[model samples]
Target: MVRKHERLATAWAAGVAGVVFALLMAAVIVLVRVALPGGADGGDVTTDSGQRSAVRTALALLPFAGIAFLWFMGALREQAGEGEDRFVSTVFLGSGLIFVATLFAAAAAAGSVLGESPQSSDFGRRLTYTLLTTYAMRMAAVFIITTSTIGRRLGVLPRPLVVLGYLSGLALLVMGANVPWSELIFPVWALVLSLNILWGRRPASARPAAPA
Candidate 1:
């Protein structure tokens, strides 16, 4: 019963993290599109007002990610105690830690840029944007791959969902390779995984256990 509740809690955390991630992505996309093109005339673009707003919005979602990470770790610990191998769990934990660390680095970068004057050169602006996008995409790739591996080992997520997770991981890899369309894949994959978390379930208990 406690194990069941733990699974439920992990699923709930993942779902909530998905929602937060979606909102953060929306805000980021809006900020990027609106603030990137005009160079220095991009009022407050490189300053504390606009940059800080975007950074704060993104950072606000990090706690949800952290929650999901903790729940995942708990699940891993439980599985290890239940005699499952530790290799995949270790990978998941390591990759998740790396992903979270990147988020912190990205947040710091945004803060630094925002705290600066708005007179950055166009080349510098583009470089910064590209760096941010690349780092974010890499982090997403690591997270998807690790989570999908965990789902496969745990036997909790459905087969189709696991497949989609792999596909999403591949898409992130392709995006990291600089393909233009890979950007669309991450959010779609996130939405799919989130929905799975929201709706997936384990069998309910009844009167008695079946004979072995």
Candidate 2:
């Protein structure tokens, strides 16, 4: 009984962490976009109190969000367990790491635009957008696709979610850069996955035992 309860508690904790991962990512996106309305080339890189504070808050949330995302990724892999295919797992891991690296790179570049030296704002803006929209989102697409494939093969993810993942992956791959805010699909997908993980779980005692 104690073991069962412990497992339940652990699962709940993981689920909550996954949701937190999604929420934090969304928050960073929202806050940053809101703060940088003029964008990189907009020539409005003002260091006003309101914009600076919002940007600072977003930057502050990023490291923790990245950590939570890593935790979430590991948790998903753990749930997939020994049955996960090697090739797909490798791609999944690689893409996830790339996504994190590029995400941070973009954030850093964007932050530099708001620094005291506004001369490099244009450069920073270009680099940030290119890194985020062009590379990071493609990696995110790969991550989503590979994860969906793994879940499909393992019979873990639902059919509809698998379909959505594939569609979103395609969108990210083909149009992520062209479409504004398309990167958001990644976090949104994570949110759905986390909710599924939370809601689909059943207690061991609640699961029906197989008859001899």
Residue 96 alpha-carbon offset, candidate 2, angstroms: 0.7
Could you tell me the lDDT of residue 78 within candidate 1? 47
Evaluate residue 192 in candidate 1 and report its C-alpha lDDT on the 0 to 100 scale.
71
Q: Would you list the C-alpha lDDT of every candidate in the order shown?
A: 0.57, 0.81
C-alpha root-mean-square deviation, each candidate? 5.8, 3.9
Candidate with best lDDT: 2
Tell me how far the alpha carbon of residue 159 in candidate 1 is from the true structure, in angstroms, after superposition: 2.5
Superposed Cα deviation of residue 93, candidate 2 (Å): 0.7
